[model samples]
Target: MKKLLFFIFLLLLFSCKKEIKETLDNNYYKKARICRDSKHSDSAFYYYNLAKNEYLKINDSLGVGNSLVNMALIQTDKGDFYGGIESSFEANKFLRRENDSIFRNRLATNYNNIGLAFHFLKDFEKSSFFYIKTLQYIDLTENKLLCYNNIGDVLISQQKYGLAKIYLEKAYLTQNSTTLSKVINNLAKAKYLDNKNYDPLPEFNRALKIREIQKDSIGLNSSYETLSTYYLDKDKNLSLLFAEKMLTEAIKNNSPDDRITALQRIITLDAKNYLNNFQHFNFINDSLQTARNKAKNQFAIVRYDVDQKNAKNQILIEKNFQQDIGIILLALALAITILWYIKRKKRLEQEKEIEVKNTQLKISKKVHDVVANGIYQVMTKIENQQHFNKDEALDELEFVYEKSRDISYEKTDTQGEEKDFSERISETVSSFKNDEVNTYLAGNDSGIWKHLSSKNKEEVYQIIRELLVNMKKHSKATIVSFRFERENDLIRIFYTDNGIGISGDVIYKNGLSSTVSRIETINGEIIFDTKIEKGLKITISFPAS
Candidate 1:
């Protein structure tokens, strides 16, 4: 009977422990939801941390990942981009391990959220890369509308308006009741950027209708704000009406960004009728500033709370380790310190090397400015001297010009000045073209030549002059064309001669070696494609400034 009583006691103890755990978990979740709804981010973060710890203790991977994502959202809202990125990455790692399709979709959403955080931080390339990755996974999932809209937003931020419009349109097409308003609003924004002013009204009206039907104050505010701006030129009365509505909703939503945007719009519109709207504009502007200051302070507090919680957790983890283990850790730490010192020294040396390169560039700029300019002036004086022998003076001038050209090339030889180099080449080529060659310069006017360092200008002139000389000597063709354009930050100079084109095999033994050497000196690349009947097409890419 005593043994039976002991078993009953053990059972009760285990059951009570489970009940207590469940109660804590449920209470933490409830508090987190309430805090988030109330915009009490610090309280939400605290509850989230409590829930996350419990989930981690129970080895609940999905629960832990979910809590981490929520914490990341709070971190993002608080403008802690680095912390948010770390949290999102951690969430993604856990979610990836879970094989469920629903969890995989959640992982994609997390990636998109991380991209948004990076976007806010002005890390556009990383934002675009991650958003694209999210889209790839989102395409295979049921949450297509959300994925499309987010991808569109990322593309828009990247200033790829054409691509943004495509994705936004797709989102609009696939959107359901939950996503319709947002998709429509995004579509309207994309359309406005695309310069489709005539059709934006329909899209904005559609989004506004959906927002009104759903009674979404934030969505309604955004739509109203956009409409006010759209109609400001067309209908002042309607614009004022919409602007007032936006201001009211923005205040109700307690969104400082929205309030600022609405006020700024009203101020701009009121400038036409300054006497009537001046008071309203001033009042809104003051309120907007106050709201912004309060939001900034609240964000700071949230960040501090998050940091404190993380510090406490870290301290707990450290305390759980054994004393002997700590001694071993100290030894390991010393070894790591030595290695880190060596790595840091090497890193510093590399940075010094980069500094040296930059110094060289600055020296080059000075040489071009002073030495090259002085040489050119001397050359001009020689050319103008009537008593100077014509052939001898020309020879002296050429020599001086060549030296000036060499100095300019040395100074501006860096990759950043290649586009300027290409434009100078094009101008030189155009100058050399006479009635005989019927030379036509085609391609976009880069205007990059205007900024070329003296050194780059000289090299470009010599290169183009060499090409023209070659064309005149070897090519028996009637027409020659040179085009200058930039593609992917590389300046492309295309030289085509209608004259008799030589085979690449034949050119291997000719002036090709000198040409190749000259291009390689400035880190420029060249491609030559020629047919027996067709003209030789020589394409060269130089680093453009």
Candidate 2:
């Protein structure tokens, strides 16, 4: 009873310790969020790093991912674009690819921030690629429109005006008032860039008016800069006025990049004060670059320290991982062995079923040729003869009956080689001819049958007999012809009949299906030209060797 009480106490103690650690981690995360909300980015990033480290101690991957994403966004805002991209990539390593909406939102935010950083760095290709990645995970309609606009902006930077317009126009149609001015500005820019004669002043002014009414200072800076650029070639004095206005708004917004851009425009348009504007440009540009460099280095150092701590933790993880891996590998090997055994057994059963099916098909073909075609041949002969011989017809019918009884046994016909094959074919066709039908055969020579194997000859003999049977039964033709030629390594045969033609869609029936199967067994091709107006024409060809 004492031992049981001790064990229970220990379990409760461990659970309490875990809960306390999680509470501490949550406190750090809360502090980070508070700092970020108050615009204390540096303090927020520091707290987030602490939160991330605490989450790592408890193996809280989602917490780690969230902290890293916030860190990346701060770095991007501070102009450390390379550092931001690195941090975002590292966050993806910790984020689990679950279908949870929160996870997807975080994933999209990470990729979109990466795209914004790359855009600022002027890596338009990478910017566009990451923007597209954002689109895949972002579910919100507003966020998706923003991604499309980002892609359009990248396209515009690359001078792909037509493609930029495609995305901008799509975003414009669905944009709310918050996004309307931005979309319209980009659309107008694409139009003006694509066609030199396109007057973009009205659209640009409309966008500017919307921004002014919304009191969007950052947007106002953009509008003023665009107006300055538009009039630079057409009206220098008006362009200089817009440049001065842009500089004033950029200063009010504390946008260093915009201020530098406006300064360059003023130096060109206001030549009298060129030196003054140039000096101001150099100072702000140099200071901004210096500040950006310092932030980049600081973020890099933070990431490097985190990596070092992770490396130390990984050493402990590796020892336990190796032990687990041995057990896993043993289980995997047993599973693979069982799977392979099952697959092999299934394969053997499938092979046996296929062998049975092939044998049945062979026997069925024998029945059709020996019994069906034989009976038809005897009937044709009797019907064509002027003086019917009862004894001869009875002998032929008796021969067919004997073949049918022994059909189950696969007996090879060796008698085919003993007789002249050409004469046999000629005799078969001649027996089919009657007062109503005239049949002709050409190239029925012994030399043509010399190179053919006994199997090939039998298949060919069966195929010819099947065709003649079909013609006698269905084709009410007055004339039929069969032409044969041996060219180099191939034999070609053409069969034609002047009767009511078959339809364009050739359906093999009345033993014609079996005839096709026979020809294919010897690697032969047969084409039926039912398109002919009068009767059917078939061309059969096969390799000789």
Candidate 3:
């Protein structure tokens, strides 16, 4: 009796849980449908995601597929073509093989959404491929007409006008529904683009009348633009009138491209005070362009992040089906570890910031000493003598420029500058050379740098220049030597100077600190050795890659 009661209790518990799950899933799905019907795309997407999550909990692949397809429609509507493509592919993957009517409908929707995404991306061949795929699952004449129209549009884009006309005509004959106006418009476009005698104005006007009766402001904007474009060459006055209609409808429908085109037509036809009128349209055009560019960039970034996350999740879920105990524990442990790591990291970051500041201060000092003094002397000479010396003035300015460039470690060998890298390096080295301290540079030629990657050469040049600057500031050497030699796959730089030998407490000054940082970044090795009687000896080695 006890065993039987326990069994009954377990069955009741399981059934109750299943009932609650089903109730919640249906609630979210119903809410999503209501939002979708109301054209609240964002709200619909949010509720659909809730439904998808609920379905995922129940392992209902069909429900999840439906939610994904629905979300993809919103994505495509928002012009996130790549994002829609990804979601549509997921829907197709899960729903394509299901033979039930609902699942088949979902698969058709996925195919259609994929086609729209590719169409927006201007990949007509790929768009046609997916549009054709929907045919096997979609039995609705209206939906089939949409597919035919899309295929025909792709053919028109490819300049296969004759073939396009056939499919478009089929679309026009498929259904006489309220949406058939768009199919007629497609047929007209095909005939007109093909340079045929099929006067598209009649069909375009017919579409305009249908949309007007339907009270679709969005649909009317397209119709108005079409009429304006079709009449632009035939009747200038009629074109201007239609253009005005297009502008009014575009403003009402929030159609930015149509607004821009309408503004251009008005600007052309209405020359008086056109610029004043254009100021408002220009602002609208700029806003639309900025929004589009921002959306595209955000879509790309979000797609990349979501793809990375989903790839990891898919792999983990495929390999493991157990309860998420490990993940939970990992998260808890990570939270604790992050607390201490962040504190330690903050201290280290502060130290690095201080070091960089000190380096910048050192550079400023060098700039003040070498640059300011040179300029002041030039000004003093001119002021005392009361004479203009263009050559001498130019020489002082060049000296100041060279020193400033060295201080900043900037590369002036831009492509348009027509400057040579070897020449730049030689100049850098010669800039430090003086009567008291001579700097010699060897193997800084094309042969040495030709095989090295641009990045590798840049870092190396920077490191060597920093070392030269430090030597000039502190080494007080009579001679400085720099040699670049390649051994096997390694590029070696051997630097020596006959200066006061390295002391025990050699400061990590700005120049030396930056050079060391560069070496570490490249995973290179550096050696420093000094003797009481010998000058500084430093050698660094890295790959030429």
In every candidate, how many clashes are there? 8, 0, 0
RMSD for each of the candidates: 22.0, 24.1, 19.4
Runs of candidate 3 exceeding 4 Å displacement = 1-40, 292-545
Winner by lDDT between candidate 3 and candidate 1: 3
lDDT of 2 by residue, 1-545 (tens): 01111211222233233333433447778898789889888778878888888777666777777888889888988888788888889888876764865666667778877887888888888888988887887666765775677788789888999999988887886556646787888899999999999999999999899988988777777788788889988999999998899899888878888889889899988889888889999999999999889888877666676654764364345366785886799799999999999999999889877966876788789999889999999989988999999998998896797588456324323333456889879987898899999999999898776688877987887788778877887877889899999988799889999987677555474448878898899999999898887988999999877
| Least accurate 10 contiguous residues by lDDT in model 1 | 1-10
Highest TM-score against the true fold, candidate: 2
Model 1 misplacement above 4 A: 1-34, 37-39, 57-59, 78-83, 96-98, 119-126, 136-142, 195-198, 232-238, 272-545
Among these predictions, the greatest lDDT belongs to: 2
Could you tell me which residue pairs clash in candidate 2? none
Q: Model 2: runs farther than 4 Å from truth? A: 1-25, 306-545
Model 3: which ten-residue window has the lowest total lDDT?
Answer: 1-10
Model 1, position 176: C-alpha lDDT score: 62
- How accurate locally, in lDDT, is each candidate? 0.67, 0.78, 0.72
Query: Model 1, 158-224: lDDT tens per residue?
Result: 7888888888777776536536676777777877877854477787888889888888776787688
lDDT comparison, 2 vs 3, better candidate: 2
